[model samples]
Target: MRDDMDKVIVERPRRGGSWQGDGRAWRNSKEAGSHLGMKRGYHRTKWLNENLAPLKRWLHKQVHRPWDKVYAELCSGIDRRSTVQAHIFEHIDDFVERGAVMRDGQVWVSASWWGRGGRAPLEEASHVELFVHPLTGILLPNRRLREARAAQRTRHGTWAERRGDKPCAVYHVIDENTQWHRVDGCWFEVTLAKFPERVDAAKREEKRYDVLRRCMVTHGGAGRRPAPDMPTHASLYGRNDVYAANKRQLGRREVRARLGDDA
Candidate 1:
């Protein structure tokens, strides 16, 4: 939130008056750009919360296509945010070079692209959680929820970063930002209510097994069925009867030369 005035190479022209009228200040494009970029991020986050907060509860209904609703709302919100960030991102290097914004050493964003792209480059900040949920799919006890919420962070990558790098926590560090982004291969941001579940200890160990073991284990649902530790892993009980009846219609098939005669 602090401006890197110390890093501002050229003295900001003294404010003879309010922005437009000030001759000494706000005189040129670069200085003006820096100011706009820093401020726009705030406007964008406020707008998103006002408009999209309702979808959080609406998305949880267990129904035929509730996920589709969640996806649609998220796409709209994230895209709006990204659009704003892209606008502010245009002038970040001026600030960054001077230390207005701080970043990690492993930079996923390039200063040149971010600096020059103007308002066109901001990708939606999707599934952005104002409220915290487990990065893992399971709903934790309230005590655990407080802990998870405290540690929650936002990041830039498309998929949930299960590795715990806390990727992209800076995407909105200053209320606004710009970067390349997408969800389901389309450009947008998604504020997730829940973080994707982490691999359980057994599943982590299972990855080392051969393909044959994987097939056998899945085919049998056999290892001491792990506890219902995650909401995502909870059994899908409702739709099985409906889907099973129609399997022939959805099942794979092959063609043969004149079925009876060929056989």
Candidate 2:
């Protein structure tokens, strides 16, 4: 292998751009003593054969471990005092190309290895790939992952966004009901049985956008709004097809009787 590494398989192109011709043919044809560049050329060729060629070949042949294993190993080896580990962990994706398939709680490496190998199993794997830590099972949200989640949230809008002001003030009405709340672009659904308890819980947390409150006060007639901001009653409540269908089925008289005349 060392002898093979020392051998120069490809020669530099000659001045006229022909690889068949020797680069140093003209110089070598001259008297040996007259070849001023021979020493530099010899050392350069030696360095390339000894160091660079082998490195390039090795890099081309190198096979990376599965992403989950790589992540687990990296996290296991983390040391707060080591700058190298910190840098590697910070740009972990750069070291490995991730391609995985997760099903039935098992993660399988799908592709992206340089050398041939069978699919590997990942321990402690999440049922779905992306953003999940391999070992700890904690979600590590990346920009793409976050963007995808945001798109999903927008496409299917949360229960709160879908419900809008249909049930009146959601914060007031659903305060004691188990319903979803969209906060900071993420949704959390919790069950509460009392209004005061929900108020106390909200007070203890960081302030978040009150989407339900804004919708209620602005469109549900709890407060006056500018003409531009005010949407028609049908527009506000009819956005949900299921609710609209149910409302239509109930008829105005039945709806009024069940939900009161204001409904």
Candidate 3:
């Protein structure tokens, strides 16, 4: 790369001088501009264009090969955060569009119908082919699958309201085998299930003061002065540092006792 730097033509000197015909002499001249300023900028841009750009272009070409071949030859051996891996994931759609990625020939079905093998086998049933991101192995859904998911949301919301439950928010719980959806305080596995008895038991055990505090904070409590150590709703929901500290204080006596024993 440094050897290529000599090839860049610097801004010509205003004062005429005989050609030294040497890279170092040209670089050292005042008209090449100060090393700290335009000279450094010129060298950096030239080196990048001459060396880095071509290398990146070559890497992209390598990525355009069939995913399995590319993975076996390149991605599998590299760290997930490596530039090559990042490039593959960032341009995943490009690979799919170009037919460089493999298609499993599987259609994406609604999560509600996923555990049932698939939705109804009718000829007009809504199902769309699923595409896989070769490098990250993430499934990308097609238009019909996306529409099905939207329709499912509408159905769930209507059902919850009809059952007299306040539709607060949607939450997802993903595990190795399944993804559970929770809406309006009801948990559904695969499809809508009865609100679990275990959740009711847990809710019954919640402290009255804690429940009251949450209610106040969530419902226009911002105008009032907050408790000295109260965590904001954003922190609580985000499970950030403030939430971690609040959690530590939840069973402070137990924690202190454990720490004393360790000491």
The residue-level lDDT of candidate 1 at 151 comes to 32
Say which candidate scores most in lDDT. Answer: 2
**lDDT, model 2, position 261:** 28
**Poorest 10 consecutive residues by lDDT, candidate 1:** 242-251
Sorting all predicted structures by lDDT, with the top scorer first, yields 2, 3, 1
Q: Which residues of candidate 1, in runs, are more than 4 Å off?
A: 1-20, 24-50, 60-66, 69-144, 150-263
Instruction: Provide C-alpha RMSD values for all models, in order.
Output: 23.9, 23.3, 23.2
Cα deviation of 222, candidate 1, in Å: 38
Model 1 C-alpha lDDT versus the unseen true structure: 0.26
1-263: candidate 3 lDDT, tens digit per residue? 12222222122232423233435665677767554543342322321122233323434555324445644543444335644334334433332321213235433232322324433311112333333444555433343443454454555556647788544433333332222333233333322111122344334422112231233231223233355334453433332111111111124354335333321
lDDT of 1 by residue, 1-263 (tens): 11321223222343322333233344354544544543432222322112221223333332233333433443443333545423333332222221112234221222242334322111121112121122222211122322232233333333445555343321111112212122222222212112223366455322222121112122123333333221111222111111011111111122112122221
TM-score of each: 0.17, 0.18, 0.20
- Clash number by candidate, in order: 20, 0, 0
By TM-score, how accurate is candidate 2?
0.18
